[model samples]
Target: MGDVRAPVAGLPPVAALVLAAGGGRRLGGRPKALLAYRGRPLLEHAVAVVRGGGCAPVHVVLGAERERVAATAELAGCAVVANPDWASGLGSSLRAGLASLPPGCSAALVALVDTPGVTPAAVARLLAAHRAGAALAAACYGGGRGHPVLIGARYFGEAAAGARGDTGARALLAARAGELVLVECGDVAAPDDVDTPQDWARWSGQPGQPGWPGSLGQSG
Candidate 1:
């Protein structure tokens, strides 16, 4: 692995890592990457969410139906990481994504495909936290830590090592809880993730309804 580059003058570049490899067992084995939010695949929306938040060179980790998703999703400029052990759990995908990141990235702002409620503004908040010298940070909803956690490059190895089963970075976060910065984002975004048919219906409300993912644009 190449050495992680240090920030030159301003905020270091933060890459967005989208974990879209989950096979939605609760949704009848549907691949979460292909889940529809608006008219585009959820993965596309996820990429857009990160891009809009100012994260450059997005990396998307694909597991379930990798080929189909690669062919169908609009991932023009994003790096795709194949997770063959996706069936193992979210941790596998998280590890794969982190491993695929280039050395130029100072940090990775990890996001999930099923989180349609997470907006660019919320992502920007996490990026800001990283810019403010936080090595680890997470968005807080109602004072509870939530998705789109930002992990500094220095902790990538520990994070990948601790990633197992469906825990993702939970173990690492818990181990270094004191170092984690929580940025309140409940006002800008919802942390609810789609896991079941009911969740799908709830998040995929009518086009014009409030909190609709498509209201702002084709992105999530």
Candidate 2:
């Protein structure tokens, strides 16, 4: 393993990867990116959370109704990537997002658009782990590991290679279980994601819930 030393200066450059291309099969063919949350698209909210957490050069992967999402959302500063095989599953979007990250990023912080409950605090905690010499880290809610996973640059290829079907980066994380640092974030964030109509209703029912929508992006 390469030296996982803490940066001598400020935190290393960590890029944000937002996977917002799901077609929302269970939600009646709606694009998850286009779904409204707190009067804004979930994509916008997800981007804001990561940005607020300090990740730079955000990259967004879009699938399903990519064009519609582009037109409907405010994605000004993020690099938008379109995945043609998004119908395959979440892994495609993950691979695309990772591949889209620019050079010089020491790591990639991956966020899912449907996971509205994940807050900027949770993202910051994971980043703190990265800066503290952890090469792999994830948010832990109630002892269960969850999203906005932080993947060191060294593992990007392995992560993208193993991201298949709906597994996303599960294979890589599982394979590196011993190295994975689980940062407890239950006190700061929720892991709920909008998958079905019931899930959508539950998410939409609460508009201004604390930590639900951090500073939103114009086009996250």
Q: How far is 186's C-alpha from truth in model 1 (Å)?
A: 0.4
lDDT of 2: 0.83
Question: What is the Cα-based TM-score of model 2?
Answer: 0.88
lDDT string for model 1 (1-220, tens) is: 1122322346568988999998778776768787677777888888888888778879999988899889988899899999999999999999999999888788999999989888888888888778878989999999999998999999999999999999999999999999999999999889999876667767765344323323223432
User: Which ten contiguous residues of candidate 2 have the minimum total lDDT?
Assistant: 211-220
Residue 122's C-alpha lDDT in candidate 1? Answer: 88
lDDT (0 to 1) per candidate: 0.84, 0.83
**Tens-digit lDDT string for candidate 2 (183-212):** 999998999887676676677763443323
The 10 consecutive residues of candidate 1 with the worst lDDT sum are 1-10
Highest-lDDT candidate: 1
